[model samples]
Target: MALTSARGWQFRQPSVLPGFGLALGVTLLWLTLIVLIPLSGLAWRSSALGWQTFWSLATDPRTLHALWISFGCAFLAALVNVVFGVMLAWVLVRYRFPGRRVIDAMVDLPFALPTAVAGIALTTLYAPNGWIGAVLAPLGIKIAFTPAGIVVALIFVGLPFVVRTVQPIMEEIDREVEEAAATLGANRFQTVSRILLPDLLPAVLTGFALALARGVGEYGSVIFIAGNLPYVSEIAPLLIVIRLEEFNYPAATAIAALMLMVSFAMLLVINLIQAWSRRRYGYGA
Candidate 1:
């Protein structure tokens, strides 16, 4: 009887082994096919060159300049997005007014617009003889075909990341908390600073990191406005393309691998912060 009862109890328990195994197999297969294969090819191609040759190519002055410019512009663009995106998200969530729906829809335009089209539009708007550019040119603020232009293109493309990431979090924030702070005689500024900012910090950082990553990898929009001047306005992605055009496959792959490593490290740090924030917040309370 004891043996029969034990068997019955075991049979009543749910069996996840088959389903878990199937899911894991499918995920691994997909990652191997879509991600691992291409990355492996890049690494293999890079390794074809001797290690010294690879190191020389990656550390060349021009290559280093391009990398520096790419990261600097991406950092600045992401910073700009963090400030304005938070304000935009706050307005969209906390206020109700005419044309609010239209404004909300427009915030997503960057996401849907073709990157090339966005680049072209920005170039046209900022070009010397263009309508907006014509006015600014008189003031000595040149934008098109400059490094500033590259930062502008990146900012245009990355804005949606910060806005979208923060918007939902702002919407879900409890109004009661703010009201409680207010009832305790906290002013609007104090209430927002003390009650709202802490809760929103994680989402803000996540958005900033995402925008930074996108800006770092951005090519289509930046290429049009950057002028592609080597060691000047050229970005790392464009440099990679130029290397490929020159048939320097090993050099291109080496640069790509380096960028991938740096980006991965940054993403890992951002994810750790996000996890820690979530734990502090106690399951999005």
Candidate 2:
């Protein structure tokens, strides 16, 4: 009788295993088609260049200069976003000023605005005779068609990532903990420094990492503003494009592969830091 009861119970249980397996299979197949396959192809094409050729292409002086410029501009942009994005997130979450909702919506304008359009708009606004550029020309601050313009374009593209990532975390932060810190004789600055910041650090780092990653791969907005002058304002992506246009497929793939590896390594380190922060704060898995 016990055996029969067990059999009946087993029969009544829902068989979701097949459905779950089907979904997992579909997801893997989709990812392979969209991402993995193309990346694998790039690696394969680059491998045809042989080690010596690959090394020479990647280590070329012009290539090195472009890499340096790309990394430098992206780093500066991400750093700026880290500061302003956090402040914007804090304001949106903690305040209820007039036009707050409108301002919050504007934070995502970069995401909705086409990259080319944004690039053109920014270029026009910062051109020598343009409104903002007219004021700065007297001070000798050239923006459009310069390295500074690259940083500006990157900042424009990356700002939304930091703001969006930190905003939700800030909104979910417990107000009671802040109140408790205040009640314990901690001043406003002390309360924020000791209580709020610690909790926000993980989210802030995640946002920074995301912004940095986006800035590193940025192309559309940057090309228009960068002037594409080799060893000067040219970026890695533009170099890759130049190589392709010159029919140097192997060199292009090699440079792209190098960029991929470096970006992956940097992102891995950032993710590790984020994971450690989350574990320390008991916030993420």
Candidate 3:
């Protein structure tokens, strides 16, 4: 007879760590305190609003518009980051140009810079009649206090995620593989498309998911550049603040709960895509 009998479950590998159950219990307790409990409270509060009231709050015109803008802008920003981030990582890893070190360091600027400060700086430069804006203003182009500005701020905040995620993967790509592709009569485009890009897809998706999450939740950097106009440039998080300021706790929590759900769904889809790619192609495919 097998040690595990006819059960589907198999014996787990012995762990070096003592007290596995204790460790698992502690992990559960930690996760509960840090994440699950707060989310549960938010859900409970939203439930207290009743389905009808919550639906009405979530479906209000301003709220709907804000939610649309937030998701739309975040998706666009993440898509842009995927392209540019891949190119940036490729360049940084493949070539040694002048100021390469400086350029590499500068990629982390958004990470180090406070979001509010970055927002103000971006607004100053992009505002109509401001430096870059002055040039664009004559051409009737505007950026600051517009939806475009939100995309720009999100791009700034989210670029590093993509770059960093994809960089290691790019660096790990073996030069010999490219050499072999060339020897097999493949051109640069074919080699990159068939070999490099497929391998990079998983990391790119993970980076996009992370950046999308950050862009969705971003508030501090966005407010200054967004103008926070109701139903025009307003974002969902800003709307939540507006509700809170007016002491509309029910509305605030309802909106918050909706945002949480939408964000979770978006991230979940991206994660599923990443997981599928990993399983289908293996890690370095």
Against the true structure, whose lDDT is highest?
A: 3
TM-score of each model, paired residue for residue: 0.90, 0.91, 0.94
- Using lDDT as the measure, what is the rank order of every candidate, best first? 3, 2, 1
lDDT (tens digit, per residue) of candidate 1 on 1-285: 988986674423467555766677899999999999998988787788779998998899988888988989999999999999999999999999999999999988988899999999999999998877899999999898889999999889899899999999999998899889989999999988888987899999999998999999999999988888888898999899999999988878888988888888989998999899899988646
**Best first by TM-score, ranked:** 3, 2, 1
- Best candidate according to TM-score: 3
Candidate 1 residue pairs in clash (backbone atoms < 3 Å): none
Off by over 4 Å in 3: 1-6, 10-19
- Kindly report which residue stretches of model 1 are placed more than 4 angstroms away from their true locations once superposed: 1-18
Off by over 4 Å in 2: 1-20
lDDT by residue (tens digit), candidate 2, 204-238: 88888889988888899999888888888999998
Write the number of the candidate with greater lDDT, choosing between 1 and 3.
Answer: 3
Screening candidate 2 with a backbone cut-off below 3 angstroms (N, C-alpha, C), the clashing residue pairs are none
lDDT of 3 by residue, 39-109 (tens): 99999999999999999998999999999889989889889998998899999999999999999999999
